[model samples]
Target: VRGTMRHLLVLALAAALLPVASVAAEESDVVVLTSQNFEHDTQASTGATTGDWFVKFYAPWCGHCKKLAPVWDELATELKGVVNVAKVDAEAHSSLRKRFRIRGYPTLIFFSQGKMYKYEEKRSLESLVAFAKGGYKDDTEAVDVPAPPDLIATLKGEFFGLLKTVLHYSKHPEAISQESAYFLAAGIVIGSVLASAFYLFLSLASPAPAKRVSQSKKGD
Candidate 1:
């Protein structure tokens, strides 16, 4: 009886750990993308080709996004070697969020051959896998992916990202670390210069103001 009980305990422990191991395996197949490396990762011109990317832009706290997490993991597993599956935390990566114009809790985009095909169908495992495999081919309305940000746009985006961080630090002084303070000060100066240069360019391009003509009663 003692040996039987020990065997049962081991079985129960194995059962408990199985799901965790499965979830980890599923997650391992999906790439975690961020604002810093997404450009190089997604752009065809940057590095060796790694197939197409099927990216999900999601917010952590969103109920819809949470509901789809398991299905997304399954989708990643299904497309493991066929397509590059990835996810972006849009709430945390403002630059990517702005670049993609992601306004919803969950947005799905498939990048193929430097073009983007939006997934507007159901988010089920089958639908996702099918779309990742070949739905972009049938879709006639593939949108051309926007070119990567230029130097000025990159600087502006970084400055805005830094400004948000500084504002957060202002509300919570305890979170302000030494490195954060140094970056915040430098970012402010650079951001000011970029802002001034942008406004100067706009001012130069704008039409000159019309001059008001004055009549002195015909020199009477």
Candidate 2:
């Protein structure tokens, strides 16, 4: 009776540990990569030459990234044969971040055929699987504007429109007033110069990752 009880206890313990062992085995296949290893892995795989798509951007401190980690891991496991999932820490790899122009944390950048698309918005195992099966289509709406015939023609038309307006005011100087016309032209020139400078300043003011992280910390 004592031997039987011991045998039963051992079996129960093994049964409990079996699932944990299976889970560990599944996790073992999932790869976690740093920024330093990203480029080398990408080059070696050549963007998963065997019908595998690559997801290559993440940030460790991001809540969204942490939330998505398990989903991403499941995706890797589910699509092991179909696609290869990889990650890079955006904060750790300044060079990679600059090279890719990563703008946000938890950004999922998909790579295939030497091209990359930023996977913006919510990420889940299902969504990623769908993206892998079909190509990732950005959620942004594209507005198509027809190009003018030529740069010279477009500039000429703009110049003529301005000239015509000026001529109208000049012809009716008594009605519109010369002072008003001079002031209007001056205001237009000044506005254009100021607008240009403002845009230039904004472009230069774009924040770096480290700066953004520090700013976020201060805000918190």
Instruction: Pick the lDDT winner.
Output: 1
lDDT of 2 at 105: 72
User: What does candidate 1's lDDT look like per residue over 1-220, in tens digits?
Assistant: 3344344334333322221111112225778776657878877334427679999997544679878887888888889889988988665456677877898979999988877888989989998888888877786478777666675566446545544544455556564334334434444555455445644555576688799998789659
Total clashes, candidate 1? Answer: 0
Evaluate model 2: give its TM-score. Answer: 0.46
> Which residue pairs in candidate 1 collide?
none
What are the per-residue Cα lDDT tens digits for candidate 2 across 23-81?
11223335555333454455432443444455656654466776777787788888787
What lDDT would each prediction earn against the true structure?
0.66, 0.49
Q: Candidate 2, clashing residue pairs?
A: none
Model 2, poorest ten-residue lDDT window?
17-26
How does residue 178 of candidate 2 score in lDDT?
34
